[model samples]
Target: MPSRWLLSILTLILASAIVVACNGDNENTETSGKETDGGKPDDFVTLKMIMPGDESARMREFVDNELNDRLKNDLNMKLELTYIPWGSYQQKLELSLSTGEDYDLFWHGTPFVSGYKSKGYIQPLDELLQKYGQNLIKNIPAENFKLDQIDGKQWAIPSQAFTSAGKFTSVMVRQDLLESVGMTEIRTIADLEAFYRKMHAIDPSYYGYLETDRGHEVLWRELSGENLTAFDERNLFAVNEDTGELVNYVESDLYKKVAHLREDWVKKGIIDKNLVGNPQSKIDQENAGKLLFRVGAVSRAMENLQTAQKADSGAKLREYFLAPDKPRYIVAPSNEAYMIPAAAKHAERAMMFMNWILKSKDNYNFIIFGVEGKYYRIENGKIKLLTNDQLMYEWMWRNKNYFTAPTNVPDDVVRDMLHNDDNAKISRLFGFHFNEEPVKKEMAQVLTVYKEKFDLINSGLVGYNSGFSSAMTALKKAGYDKVFAELKKQFNEFNAGRP
Candidate 1:
């Protein structure tokens, strides 16, 4: 028989072996990526990001030829980028997510984050940001993450969105036309109508009257208070932030008022009916120099000016801010962001990449703007844009400190783009995010009705009385009542659960 000390030693050895074997199995199954005893990855990991838009020759060359070498050296990892054509992007991404495709990060928008989160398609970044996103935490404001969180956990990282806290409903007009009409500036919708009438009377070319079909869109919703936020992507239903009351926007008095206002504009010939559903017609009109005025992104005024100048040398475009009194809301859906996949193999590595990109102005410029002289150029402190394909889709990786406008872009337009959302107010629904899962079927039916009827009314193409009647009938049939109840229930639950 073995001595007492010797037997104890053998027993300890066997237990230690069993633990090691069990740990090895669990680590391989539950976790991913190879790591050493020191808790660092044993081998260099390759992280891939997929986004929309086709890759250009120059972008391809820079990624494979130049960018990877630095990435490999600095992070001990390789970054691969892939693009899908915009037409097929959403479909492909959905298929990939459903089928458990292997990817680390992706580009998306804030509104869809709820859909992704509720469906278990994404991962929370609280711990990852704590460990590897120190720079992001330091640079990005804490308030910016409120809307991106679900159940108080950060689910996505908002990239630089050149927007002010509040939405502005502004019009871009041909300054040359305004000058010809002896108008210096337009401050109100009344002044705008006068200007439009004068231009129509003189030119008699209605195509140049208002090109608001596609390239130009009037965000007249700002005329409503910022306290209202959309419960649906379609904005058919909006939640009153102050009261947390769900209001059916399509059925509201405000909706009726705006629909009538637009009907009046169409009747008075201030807005063209032909351009109602024909966006291409408006685009052609703008490019062909027939557009007198349009409502759209004031930030794109420089681009519009440049394109217009090519047709008429004296063409000047001016942007006018229409809403100055209403407080801007900050927790709206973001148009662009970088999100980690729920099944990411190396989420920490992805955060490391984001942190490194934001660590310095130089890194942000390199990653977002690309090789200065080759992809873009800075002349006398003003940056000039060139054909950069990577920067086009990788806009989600942008940081504003490194952002510079092209020489053609005006200072005011640049300010509007950069300082957008600076003074935005937090929504009463700031901490609460509504998940549409419970009413998904009804919401889908509601949207189909909205697209067919409410869209025309919202656009001011149809008169409110008849449009409202038809829409309400269709909405009820599509089960808008069900959407209404679910939204109310969710809002109450969300509020009651709050401290």
Candidate 2:
């Protein structure tokens, strides 16, 4: 009887051990599942973000303390931001990607999308986005997603604000000068020319038009109504309005006319002769009250005027939209995008961050506008300036949905500029992306020629006819014909697939 009782006791002990082992296995499985599927790991993770422009020390502290705490509570992640100045951003980004640095997300422009995708540095976010970025998908328009796609795969998340409809360039003239010249309004290019002449007559010391070298292209696009779309690194080929054929922009008659006009302005001393490669000079002159006229997008006119007024309180600015009579809206693809590198250790988290930015107004405003009460205040649904704590290049991440008007400008004016679609004119090739792989070499060579020859012509350093002719010859010699053919083939394929 004693032996039998001992046997029973041992058997019961063995059974209890089995049950304990099974429970341990279940717990291990659950923990593993949590780690692999969206749940936080035992150790915290840090996401490294690279962006353009310098963030103030105050801003950094706020982000690290306040923003990081919030992200940690919500995502179990912290953000480490690195700001590269605008001029050095591209080079630094390239080096970082090439070296396989331990970075997560970065700001990028549309031009580099294809190159980055082809190099395998960036990953397609279709699956991750669908899984984690539902808010992003919902907020951004379908057309915008199409713009960021290449070969039917999305490579980046485009900012939801001002995706395409903000291309409103106008001639900005000093109101005080306009009145001084007896001109209340400038209705046409001829009227602009007359104003420039009058302003030059009034104050020959002041530059009539303080436009930069790149402003030449802006003027050309405004006058011709034919947008210059880049085909390769070196060439801009615009679609012929009448024939629907692509033509080299520099060789076109319209380009020649604009060049001639530029030369005439230079001869008449209506434009600053020393404006080439000196873009800062325009800003300096405007602030010093030495510029009578300038050309830029209307959205920035008020801001520019406000800044100018700081230097000279009497300074007042007004905008005259080019071709007001025609009044057509020009739409292009979104140029700004946020991309995640394929080598990122935390891509899902990055997607989560993007989702947060798109969906939450607080998150978006924090990243864009800085600490609200410190940088700006909200009164009557308008944003009032408190301190210039704003990032110098805030537009880099501007989301239109959450954008607030500055106190200096009327809220209605800002709202109208972004949303008014009464005369909206969408481009036929609005979503079209030029694939430059086949003609990349030719494109490079053509771009070299442009830098050498076209800059001289546009800056009025060389005579119009000779400079235009020389640029055309140089382009043709650099295998422009091949580039054009490649662009035509790819454009045809793209057009055929358009729905």
Q: How well is each residue in 1-499 modelled by candidate 2, as lDDT tens digits?
A: 1245434533543343333223321100111122332444454678888987657886677777877887787667799888886556888998999888878888887667777877778877766666567677666655566556676567788764563332434566777677878888766777777777787776677777735343543465456766443332233566543345677666677767777777877887776677556655665676677877776554555556566667666666766655564433333435668888878877777877777766677777766666678766788776776654554245554556777667666554466456534444444455567766777788779778877878777667687767676677888899888888887888777667544
In terms of lDDT, the poorest run of 10 residues in model 2 is: 24-33
For 176-214, candidate 1 gives per-residue lDDT tens digits of: 888899997756667777888888888877443443222
Poorly placed runs, candidate 1 (over 4 Å): 1-46, 76-78, 85-92, 161-163, 168-186, 191-233, 239-245, 262-319, 333-335, 343-346, 386-390, 393-400, 416-424, 460-463, 493-499
Instruction: Show the colliding residue pairs in model 1.
Output: 163-420, 164-420, 164-421, 165-420, 165-421, 208-290, 208-292
Report the number of clashing residue pairs per model. 7, 2
